[model samples]
Target: MTNPRQPHQPRQLSLNAFLHDTGHHEASWRHPESSAERAHDIEFYVEQAQKAEAAKLDGVFFADIPGLWAATPYRPTAHLEPITRLSAMAARTEKIGLIATASTTFHEPYNLARLFSSLDIISGGRAGWNIVTTQSEAVARNFSLATMPDPAERYARAQEFIDVVTKLWDSWEDDAVLADRDSGRYFDPDKVHAINHVGRFFQVEGALAAPRSPQGRPVYVQAGSSNEGRAFAARNAEAIFTAHQTLGDAQAFYDDIKSRAARFGRDPGHVKILPGISPFLGDTEQEAKELQQYFNELTVPAYGIGQLESLAGISLGHLELDERVPVELFAGSGDVLDNNRSRLQVVANIVERDRPTLRQLLHRLAGGRGHNVVAGTPLQVADIITEWFENGAADGFNVMPPLYPQLLDAFTAGVVPILQERGLFRTEYAGSTLRDHYGLPRPDSLYAATAAATTA
Candidate 1:
């Protein structure tokens, strides 16, 4: 079955709603309608997943962190593990794709591969893995590492990790299972092969414990913006979750990554780049602005300062909140700047363009740092999305709401209708699995084909 909104055709767009626990904004928990306390509740996530499915959105994504951000009163911290949460969501929702973040830096390749492969079978192939090389120092400590490895070192390990995992997934042939009761020989040892991967990061001398999943492999999604990150995505990612503050930046990233795919002998169309967008909605433009301001007012300045200190490598706690961010702080932080190039570039751009005060920077970055934060009516939001999609700036968007359910519902009910009417989004699901939902072909079972050829 073909997706009506397949990208091979003109003017078609794909959308994935990125669901945060309470909301994208750090202070979203303070809102009256926000259910921050329900972050740990399975029912809360299930209801949100159901809503996205009801809206006929393509997928629902969950972002994760191995360690809690420095304890803050301004925002909620930690919740259910993402893979388990997505598994629960899979039970409740039938069609929508379920994507979850898992870091190669923290997880062993064999265990990680098995986990996603199991999820694919459980969800009937509606699972996706958002690969990330976690960068937090705190996360490194939790994993028994002295410190986070340099960016290049992490990417090198990630490449090997993925290689080992993919081989493991391909180890079991599709026809390996033979549940024949009469013969009482429910086995096909010849069909199941062992993966002897001896890479720098991992070495696995056996096949994956599970059978080949429905999709062969879970949909490979990535969310990294550095040079190594982009290269990794170019070679391996089917979907990319990225952040950009402007259309020009988004377009540049889109072109660069697509161009890089050619070198990997990959079809550029196979890599779908979705930038994060957090919408602040209201009845009128003025009301939307006011709502954005309300969230800004609720942001904790100290938390922002701590974040800034981490980013710029300078402690801002001693500085006055009303004062301009010190220029001296950014001068010698080239190493820090290069490490998180995308985010540092965003901060530098904002500093140069807006010259915002320390308090103002906190408000500006209150929602998912520098991702396009727009406040307007649904039609207006749809216009922005349509413009971006049609103009080659985006394949789709990662729909983030400043607050959940309330804001997500507004976008689904209001903006989605406009997009559907414009032929930019889907009105109903056209396929069952996440691969089918994305108009992707199910990968051939390497083991199965090899065994069949050998027998013949």
Candidate 2:
């Protein structure tokens, strides 16, 4: 006789380790445990992936910027190409999703589709693509553009670019390759088709050269929080990475994006929203706070001021660092449609709410760009995560450690165990694919679904 089981429990939270060279802190390289020079070592990344997998974390993410972020002389700024590196790490670890950031603005649809498809296959369906539109004017110049591409134009192209790529992924049906040896037959020609995709920005005339990947296609991810970004994500993204400083802000964004998805005839519950968090951990609350302060003291005021000026789009070099920044400094500089708008608003919100001095604000931002920074013991950190997960502020978090290996080790070894005890996270991986790790279903091919619907 079959055994009967108890009632099913609710779904668990999804977590990703957002990996950087040393860590998320600006001065992380100076930390005793982190070495900035190890950024390019494949073994370094291999070790991190293994650590995350050992903890049963869902995934590892690599953020990319196509241009120089700052001209700082100190700190490490180098990064390995993500897909190539993920491909290497795929061989070293099992059951951990590998996500890479790729820009739609610079790559052709055909090549990008092939690249991610290859990664999904290489990783046995554990590949995800973080879609972004390159916005830096410096990077634009490298692509032969005399000026920055307008934000509206970039979003429009991105929407169509996604449509074309998804079509390519669906061009070959799962059973297209019969490989009959006795008859000396290969793939069935009728099951394979030409996408013949022609769009405003991209034109392609052939089917994708690869067979269907294990998860059907790589998972789609987005990081932008603008209106256009929300709409695009609603139509396409299965997961979103975002930044917000307060519970209210996070709830609002979560509701807005899910509502947008509903309007697009999608099931909002399928889209996972993960905000970034940089945790400074210790055995006691007081110790955690002290460690956070230590990192802040290491911040170079000049570099911080330079970064602040870049975001505000106004000169602050002449102002006293201890003086309160005038709210007018951000006026007329960023609009909702501009590239700087989202990040600028994050800073403006901080100034308006707390009215901190420039020095104080810089220190607050030094840890995780604009993501919320939490300092506490393991249980305290777990409380914040549980509250967010339970109260609808987030589906999960992009866990960023302020220092490499050590802080990450602290989180997984200390905090994750607490979460597991509370039944808020998984004790073991549920399946092999990245989609399975995220609790997201593999998508059906558009053509196959359409034909089945017609027959029914």
Candidate 3:
């Protein structure tokens, strides 16, 4: 079958509904339409998934922190586990892909493989795993560690973890299972091979318990933007969930990853780069800015301070909210900045660009927490998305609405039609599986492909 995800006449845009509890904004729960209590409500997510499906979005994505993200009392930081939530969404909605975040730093390879494989089967081939090397000392404590592993060590382990998982996924050939009662054999034993994968971080000696999924394996979605992260995504990721504050940075990243993929002997076109976008929409531009400002105004200063402290790796609690933040506080040598890249880079970008006071900086990050926040009318939002897509800055966007099912509703009801009218996005899903949704080909199992080649 021809892969639906391959490039066709029109360059279709890939959009995902990046679902958050109340929403993406730090103070989203304070909105009249939001409720902290509803964050745990399965029905709330189901409604969100259904709405994305209605708009013909490619997928619904959920990001997880594994531990308490920040001061929970100040902000509603509690969240449902991502993979489990996506499973629940799978049953309630069809067509939209279900993508979940899990950490390589904490999860075992075998268990992670089994979990994603099972989800792929259960979701009828609509599963995608957002591979993440979680960066938090707090999360390390939950896993019985005093400090997080260094970046090099963590990425090394992640590479081995993914290698073992992929080998396990490829162990069971597509034709291994046969429900032939008359022959008295349910499966072909010869077709099922033990991986015997021995890696630096993991070892596995058996086939995955689950058979090859409908898409061979769940789509590999990665979310790392550091140097090692970029290299990792180039080798393995089918889709990347990324965050960037500027168009130039996004384009540079897009070019670098594609070139890296080509160097790895992989089709660069197969790897989709999706930057996160938080759209706070209104019928008019001023109205949109004011609505986003309302969420910013609701942010507790203490919460923002704590967040900045983590990013800057310094004690910013002593700083006055109205006073201009000392730029030199976070200014360090090249080696030091490279050590803590993603969040620090984002923070530095904001600081250098605007040189805001502590209070101003908090509001700046309040919208998408470092992702680009576009507060505008429907046309303005659509135009921005189109500009990014057409200019090679992005393959698509992970649409993060500041408020769940409300701002999300606005984006779909308002902005999506403009994309559809311009023929930049799909009006309806042409295929069923998540791979199909992303225009990725269903790959053959390594064993199956190898055996076929040998026989020929």
Candidate 4:
């Protein structure tokens, strides 16, 4: 079968190593492959970043949370702040993009704009902002709110938040910084205009504190699958981080989101939908399955019950381990219970299909709940990625390693070379910035366009 897109000629797949504390699974630190002792150490993260850069991967991403999860013996609860760590990482690595998550729900637009702009400047343009509206109730208390806002309200505020932030980034014209010591003028006041943004959620009447970022703005990345989330991403996200358990699910999401992009007058091709993939690799298929089993066996059932409580919104302690979850438990939920619909759906599907005991379900989700988890040899793993990318089920992937550095090392060393040999991945980065790395066009400064038009 001849494919029209085949002329695209195995477009080099984008890969980002999603660096979690030790690994993506909550119980990974308990595994022998992970180093729990160094989870808090900055050097550990820096080394991971360096490894990704050395492998010539596109970027390294750090997911963040503003509040702690319910105390669990199985999971490490502590984490270093992502932006500060990435700032330190910027100094050590030269090429790989540094992406960090920041929630719009808890932060002011002006401040976030300055933070990411500064990161872009420091990293010489390789910066990405993974925009998220936090789904944690615990986070609300930290921000002096009684409870988390509704998802619809959060998305509304997020839209305005992004609009205001982009305006602030655009406030300082590209040529605003003169740096002409001879004239004793550091900037052109006329060029540095105030955003004067007034919106339903916030009001800021000034320009951003920093100069223009190297890429004009940090690459706008988003990771949400709700309808509101999809709309927001279609309008603003350059890259999307998504999670799905099956090939059918991933393809459905891929088609839906890309179809929505066109309604916003965006080139569907411009919004890269990268599903999260957690691969467990070994010399042979049996060894890989054994490795996966090892991690699942290491999982603590109590912790899994706690996590399942969050997803199902029903305490599982009363239910027998071997009993099937009742469908009635999910009926007519309010926002608190339904905040994570995607995750809830995954749980429902698992319960319906596998009919697994409580103990078994916990093990199934140990490696990253509902995201595609594959246990195979390097060739087998590569085949999955190739099939997904070639079949339009994914543009690429946000690689979630089941264990840190070792799992990452295996993918970069084993799977990456196969991809390169097959011309499905790049041997060297095509450009420097995150935008360039993703083949996205740099947006022209709104200020620049107005000025040139006025002069003519």
Best by lDDT: 2
C-alpha RMSD by candidate, in order: 2.3, 2.8, 1.6, 3.6
Candidate 4 error regions (>4 Å): 1-10, 326-339, 453-456
| Candidate 2 local Cα displacement, residue 182, angstroms | 1.1
The sequence of per-residue lDDT tens digits that candidate 2 reaches over residues 1-456 is: 111111385767999999998999999998776767787999999999999999999899999877655657867765778999999999999999999999999888999999999999988989999999978877788788888678789999998899988988988888888889987879988777788887799889868999888889898999998767888899899999999899998998899999999999997877999999999999999999999999999888888888877776679877788999887777753366654688778888888888889888999999988899999999999999999999889999999999989999999999999999999998988788888888777788876777679889
Candidate 2 ranges beyond 4 A from true positions: 1-8, 332-335, 454-456
lDDT of 4: 0.85
- Model 1 CA deviation exceeding 4 Å by range: 1-8, 326-339, 448-456
Residues 1-456 of candidate 3 have per-residue lDDT tens digits of 348754456678999999888888888888877867788999999998999999999999988878988645877777889888888888888788999999999999889999999889888899999998888888899899999988889889989998889888888998899989999998899899899988678778978898888888899999887778888899999999888888898898899999999999998889999999999898899999999888888898888787777777789867888888777876751232222566577777778878999998889888887889989999999999999999989999999998887898899999999999999998888899989878888888888888989999
Report, for every candidate in turn, its global Cα lDDT versus the true structure.
0.84, 0.88, 0.87, 0.85
Q: Write the per-residue lDDT of candidate 1 for residues 1-456, one digit (tens) a residue.
A: 233345566555778889887899888988988997798899988898899899988789988888886656657776668899898888888898999999998999999988999899988888999999988888899988999999889989999988888888888877788988988867688877888888787879869999888888899999888778989999999999988888888898899999998789987877898999999988999999999999998887878887777776667777677888765556643333233666776777777767778888888888877788999999899999987887778989899999988999988988999999988777877778887767776776666767668889
Report the CA-based lDDT of candidate 3 relative to the real structure. 0.87
**Candidate 4 structure quality by residue, lDDT tens digits, 1-456:** 111232354566889999998897767888765789998998999999999988888889998879875666568887888899999999999999999999999899988998999999999988999999998888889899989988889999999999998888888888899999999999999889787787788999978898888888888999888778888888999999988787888898899889989998998877899999999999999999999888888787888888888866688887887676665565543232323876677667676666777777777788877787899999999999999999888888999999997999999999999999998888887677887777777777777778879999
Report lDDT (Cα) of residue 349, candidate 3.
Answer: 73
Q: Any residue pairs clashing in model 3, and if so which?
A: 5-439
Distance from true position, residue 400, model 2, in Å? 0.8
TM-score of 3: 0.97
